[model samples]
Target: MFSFEDYREILRLVKESGRYATYGEALEREEFIIMRHDVEYSVDRAYALSRVEDSMDFRSNYFFQWTNNSYNILSRKNRDLLTDMHERGHMIGLHFALNGMTDMELIRRRIRQEMDMLSDMLGFAVNTFSIHRPSPAVLAENIKLPGILNAYQDEFFSFDPKAGPDSALRVKYLSDANHIWRYGYPDAETIAAHPRIQILAHPFAWTKKGYENEENYRTLIREKYAEMIDSIDGECKDFSPYREGFMGMLT
Candidate 1:
């Protein structure tokens, strides 16, 4: 039942604790919570989640994948959504997809190309990135690119209990992957126990009404198809001659 209400409750707990901070702000603080969203499915969902966060005066980082064809980041509709999120005080970052790429030099090249393109499209400089479906080798390397903060890097986050004992700063990370909270939902009890925490939620996993993972994808596809049809209808209206022909073809 991870609906919008559930999301609101999570924010309420974070606000009550007064430990929530954006990724950039968290870097400066000794102990803080980093609320992040990876936009893998729909920008519309991201916008909806951003509105929820706005109501609670909470700011988080949204990392978007340029490689994902499900949503066009450069499209006017999505660009507007991103702009709205930015205006609402949420930071935007790159969700870089290695796609099992093993070459270090090639990885760096692709990262720069995508980051620059995305930054230009958003009219903002993206300084942070999170690897999308990173492989074991990529995670082990922990390569840090210039001018960008690596979310997966050891310096920023760690899940090792042994590392926690050795290092002064400890990072507790949790994520909602495949519509399931693998590490369990971050309730008040969980938040209180961890001094430094990172909660990664995917916007697509949440909805105004609770939906299963498959239902979320179906809804998005339906909406996208309807949007395309509407655009075509609008264009046909301008060209009266084509309107009749297009309508006939449908019939």
Candidate 2:
């Protein structure tokens, strides 16, 4: 949750469990633990984690937001990183934003549209998506597209508002949302117990030093400043002349 080594430890634990599987691979297996990373803040951070997994010969799903204000997924630098991840056998999926609308049909339509657009942009079919930060209503809806895999679907995500406590899980779900282990940290024993598991980890919260939440945001803000400076320099010729003044403080 904090350090890259910490993340690697979890990856190692999952791999050694002999139950690890990708989402697509899960389609054929009953005992599978699918590792998912939602690119919440930085694709760079996501790519770093991807590299960590790659070093261990592990592949996981990485979902990126097309509409995120923090990072531009369509940017050339990001596209290159994404392509590299895909080339290395990592799955790139869409991190969808509902934008406040909860209509099931409309959500379905928009997901397809975004996936198709992202797929076209990346030159690879994005066959899956994970909701950015879902509302309870969205979870209850349990949306599923014809050919696309919804990360929140009943198969992977078990949720039923009306069913209340009676609703049982088909696949155990765990998340490092808000930089905390929401559904009991996926420890060694937990991983061994659950046959079908889906883990959602955000790459942005982790760093080499394992900074605290406040420290993490400060780091992200500094990164954002560098990104904005580059963005302006790229978009406007005049900005380049004065770009050095701000860029100098990045370190």
Candidate 3:
């Protein structure tokens, strides 16, 4: 059961391991673990995770995708969530999506545009970025944009060679993508043994209770669609005919 309690236990183990460090701190520490959360969906979920981290006095880098329509980054509710996370010492980063874009120049332009927008919205400079489902070409290029640290770059941290590594770097990388641990479950034993590690957990993969990947996604979709219907109905109350079909579909 990969519930919130499980996550809290992981953090507790990391604290006991005497090797946990934030991504920024890992640069100087010989032995450390970098905790990273990519906000693929549900800022509320991310906020919940942040609270757990806060309880442990731990810090992590949270990357948010502006291109993701699953949650509005600019919405008042989400903006407040981001602010709360930032205030609690979690690093806010831009999760850039390539979307099969091959042009380096255009990619750089888009990167800067989103960085500027996010920084302005957060009222602070966002200095880190990670590519969302990057293509082979982008990975090969390893293009570094100005003024932000690339989370995918080798310069950040090395992965341990033994752990079915993903990047060229020599650090142990563990990921919970699609609500399943791709490498292996990052338990206390695994965490204590590794000198340097990178833990990538998607906020949407976790909930207060255990849920399968498909189930979690379905819940998010239903909630977002319901919210959209409410917004539309509120804006066009006079146009009952236009909303009837949409409301019926939702019901």
Candidate 4:
């Protein structure tokens, strides 16, 4: 988990250290960038990151899951909001939990259903996806593997670290049940050093000027949302990949 301070420090380091030169060079040479987040349990973080993206004038894919208390498909408000976000120019993707899909047919079918539901709500078929809770060993093996993610616009939307070889950039992320960035965690610096673009997911668990405070947390969330919208209003750059499933790793 990465705290706000941790991200700030990373920003500072990237700005000060020349290490980013290579990364920047790669971005220019490759003509692309990376910004990904897996929205597992709730859209709270999705909303937060939307703000962050809006602030930075950046747009990235956000994978959201469907389950009780996670994202109630029954909520018309939620559906409309998600759709509006899509119309506003953000990628709405599936965050699949397929660990129990022993049957390949079942896996594809489930994926289709999820994609259809999300896509329909957003008035378009989603092409991108990221898994929830797939083990690292599995992830590494999956990085390069292929699968049928029916109803998606692109197969590359699937984010799998397991399908490929080991990476220096990927690091251990000790986290709460739902992935969220935690600055309070001590190992954030170590995890941040990894080159793999790791997403920090967090539920809206309350915020604090000093410690956990629900009211203040809610306020911060509101403020951040407003800030994010304002940020997007200023300027934005699209960094989605040109090739369907390719995003460069700073190796």
Best by TM-score: 2
Candidate with the greatest lDDT versus the true structure: 2
Candidate 4 per-residue lDDT over residues 1-251, each given as its tens digit: 23343434443443333322221233243121233456644465566556544554444566677753435533565576677667766667777787665555665567677777776766786765666665444343343213323112122223344433232322223233322334223233643444423333343432222224455355545554554444454444542332222212111
- Residues 1-251, model 3: lDDT tens digits: 55788888888877888887765677677787778888886787888888878877888889999887687878887899898888878899999988778898898888888898889888988878888987766666666765567776664544233435444345777888877686667897778666778888888777788577787777667666767776677678676676767756755
Show where candidate 2 strays beyond 4 Å: 162-168, 233-244, 248-251
What does candidate 1's lDDT look like per residue over 9-123, in tens digits? 9889878878787666777887788888888868888888999888887888999988886778888878888888888788999999887789988987888888888888899
How much does candidate 3 score in TM-score? 0.83
What TM-score does each of the candidates earn? 0.85, 0.91, 0.83, 0.52
When summed lDDT is taken over every stretch of 10 residues in candidate 3, the lowest stretch is 159-168
At residue 92, what lDDT does model 3 achieve? 94
Worst 10 residues of 1 by lDDT: 159-168
Clashing residue pairs, backbone N/CA/C < 3 A, model 3: 158-170, 158-171, 159-169, 159-170, 159-171, 160-170, 160-171, 160-172
Q: How well does candidate 4 match the true structure in TM-score terms?
A: 0.52
| Clash tally for model 4 | 25
